[model samples]
Target: MANIKEHLLNTLEELATEDLKMFQWHLTNNVEDDKHIPKSRLEKADRHDTVDNMVQKYGQIGAVEITLDILKKMNNNQLAEELRTKVKNN
Candidate 1:
């Protein structure tokens, strides 16, 4: 079987430098462009509260995991670029 780490590294290497920049931007931007929607519970709690911690805690297959899975299956480089941009950089 192909190693996932090697595949990720290869994918990273193949992406254009600017695409990488955009990817990073999407990861950090989170709710940019008035797109920050809240969950049912959070909406009842606080409008300005960040959902990051909550998601990291309770979300099964957190955003990063979901994004990686989607990236692996969709095989759409553009979608992968968008999804990766929002992921927290290690």
Candidate 2:
């Protein structure tokens, strides 16, 4: 059987550069989704506020785990591994 950790790491390595944008986009969307405000009202939200909201909703580790899961589900293994390493080393 393939090692899931290695597979995830390989996927991260392969797509890390390109998939970063995709991951960030998804992260932003996911964070926004948790907001109670209407989508139409979110236009005034600042980047820092949005990120703060995400951390508020998920905490640091939880937010990272959620984003990693999102990347994995989207078949963005390379980017996921890159994030995993960042989190691990930080």
Candidate 2 displacement at residue 62 in angstroms: 0.3
Q: Lowest lDDT 10-mer window, candidate 1?
A: 45-54
Per-candidate Cα RMSD to the true structure, in Å, reads 11.4, 8.9
Residue-wise C-alpha lDDT for candidate 1, range 1-90, written one tens digit per residue: 433333344444554655444333333444344432334433333211222433443352354453354345435557566446534342
lDDT tens readout by residue for model 2, 1-90: 433333334443454444544544555565446533334333444434434444566666665677678778788676778777766765
Off by over 4 Å in 1: 31-90
Clash pairs (backbone) in predicted model 1: 23-85, 26-85, 26-86, 27-85, 27-86
Please list the residue runs of candidate 2 whose C-alpha ends up more than 4 Å from where it truly belongs after superposition.
Answer: 1-50
TM-score per model over all chains: 0.35, 0.49
